[model samples]
Target: MSSVRRIAREEWRLWLRSKVVVAAALIVAVLIAVTSILTANRIANEQAQRVEQQVAAEQTFFAQPDRHPHRMVHYGHYAFRPPPPLAVFEPGVDAVTGQSIFLEGHRQNTAMFADTKAAADLGGFAALTPASLYQLFLPLLLIVLGHALFLRERESGTLAVILAQGLPGTKLALGKAAALLAVIAMFMLPLIAVAAYSVTLGERMLAAFSLVGGYFVYLCAWGAIVLAASVLLTQRAVSLGVLIFVWLFAALIVPRFAINASSAAVDAPGKIESDLIMLAEQRKLGDGHNAADPAFMQLQAEVLEQYDVETIEELPINWRGVVAAYSEAELTDLLNSYAEERMRLEASQSRIFGLFGLLSPTIAVSSASRAIAGTDLATHHRFLRESEALRFGFVQALNEKHAAELDYAIDMNRNADEAARLRARVNASAWQVLDEFRFAPDGADERLGRAGGSLGILLAWLLAAGGIVLVAARRVRL
Candidate 1:
């Protein structure tokens, strides 16, 4: 144990004396700090702006003159997803998933204005969010620190001297691993600080802590893999090249391939297909234009019978309002069904990517990070589902008001003059009565549980790498 501690100390001293390692560590730390500050400020500003726009849009919608409830449903409402508090630590899929979604009767709109798909390839590479930085660059830095740890010692004939001093090979390997872990700690400090500060800003403290923990484990895994490769290869240059190849494959090639494979496997329906299918289904259910249509006429007859009125004129409730309510219900059902189908498809695609986590720990880390951030595909689907529910509730409430409050006598018969006047007006107060959309962030425990399986894959990889390192160390000659 004393010898191990002495070796760890010596390795640390050696790392500090190496200008390349010191400079690389400093650069990475600065980049992390800069990214944290920039992302925090940018996300805060964007969210504030979105809130203002939503309020203004709501006010404008309600300020208009009174109109039929059905008209308001077609007019639609917009809900902007609020950015999560820990977004600074891991932007995750925020850029890939659109922030604003339109909610309306008879249609389910996909969220729009995604930053990821909007940018050119160059911008994609240049964007410096936490996920991008860590996923693409951090492993390379780990490789730089780890590739020479043992290989260089062997190359310099120092291993024989150390072995002659009676140090066990496994202990030496552990000491070197400990030294690399220290460098990993340094690389992770800024992110940990960012996570700590996120708690004070009303972020989920436990989730933020878990994010930091996950990142630490991820970087340590990279270091371990690099160390194992260094021990396996006899030439320092060969070890460096092999480690770079490993980093490239794990970090870049594998993830891109997984995404492509998932995309190809499921073939997610494009927006056009979804829109056309929904339109066709809506028409099949009941187009308001054909009041004489069998479905509409049957609904009208049922509603009249329910009220025990022989004539539509004698009905206590406004018949038009009743028709609107029935139609809205049918529309909601169709849209919800279509939305669920799309969500299922997307989930299938994500599952394919999740399976790749076993092959590349980077995939596992990326998946875990996004899940914790609440900006992954699953969260986006949830937001869309909740938004649609809210839309249905408000639209249905307005439709019911049309049936209960409006006098059927005046509303049923339409003279050209009265029709124009009615078309031009509605109770603005009705709009004010509708609830605003709010996105609830998932609880820390829920997020941790969702990400737990992926973390298990990562841990499994680490243990496997550790085992390999053990075998390599035991086989080392002098």
Candidate 2:
């Protein structure tokens, strides 16, 4: 223990004396601090703006004057997903998947207002977020700092003298690795502070801890790989080159390959293709606007038999409203079926991507970070589901008002006479009976559960790297 401490202390002193090392460390630390502050503020401002927009949308909806219930359905509503607090660290798919969706009858609109799809008036270098900084550059810095940790001593004969004096190779390796880990801790100070800030956001303690822990393990894994390469490769230049190549392959190449592979493996339909297919299937269901269509004729017969009435006029309810209600229910069922299939396809693609984590710790840590931050595809899917539920329920409620409130005679003649149209309108107070849409993100426990697979992958990487490091350290010689 004492020998290890002495070696680590000496290594630190040397690092402090090197101008390049000091400058590099200072620049990264400052960037971390600046990015953290700016990202946090931007997320907070966007969240506040979305909240205000949501409130205004609800107010405008309920403030409408009396009108036909079907008209209200076409008027639609907007659901703005509130960004989770941890999004300050890992905004994940938030920028690309969009922040809001439009809800109306018979159509499940795609989410909109995505930052990526917005006007590109700004520079294209906006990918430099806090998560990117940690995932991509930090490991490269580690490689540059420690690629020659023990190789330099071995080449200069200091390692031979130390071994002659009875310093076991394992102990020397442990000491040097400790020094490297100490440097990692210094680099992680800004991340730790970010975690602490996240913990104050109420009920995010577990997520915050998971975020910091995942990154720590990821960096530690890199440290082991670095030392293993440095001690085993003999030549410093060879070790440096190999480590840089490994970093590039793991961080950049594997992720892209995995994405392309998953796309090929899954073959999910594009938006336009999906829309066209849905429209074709909908045509088979018969036109809802034509009450004389065979589908509606069968429905009318069923209603007449149920009520034991001879004519539409003798029915106790407005026949038009009943047709509207039936059409909506059938349409909603069709929409839900397609929506579920799309979500299932996306989940499969994500699972395929996750399998590649075994080849790259970068993918593992990134998956875990997004899951912990509630910014993954699963969370976005949850938002879509909640919004759809709101849309379906509100639209159904309006259909109910349409059937029970308006007179059949007035509705049938509404298009011809202004007086009949006025009589067919349901009171605007009907919208008040519907509930507002609010997205519920997963709780800490749920998020941690979702991240479990990726975390396990990271653990496996660390353990495997650690074992290689130990064996390679043992083989280190004069």
User: Which pairs of residues collide in candidate 2?
Assistant: none
Give the Cα error of residue 7 in candidate 2, in Å. Answer: 1.7
TM-score of each: 0.93, 0.96
Worst 10 residues of 1 by lDDT: 114-123
| Candidate 2 TM-score, C-alpha based | 0.96
TM-score, predicted candidate 1 vs. hidden true structure: 0.93
The positional error of residue 333 in candidate 1, measured at the CA in angstroms, is 1.2
- Per-prediction backbone clash count: 5, 0
Candidate 2 structure quality by residue, lDDT tens digits, 309-408: 9888888888877887788789878877888888888888998898899999999989999999999999998998899888888888887887789888
lDDT of candidates 1 onward, in order: 0.79, 0.84
What value does the lDDT take at residue 245 in candidate 2?
91
Candidate 2: stretches off by over 4 Å: 114-121
lDDT measured at residue 3 in model 1 versus the true structure, 0 to 100? 78
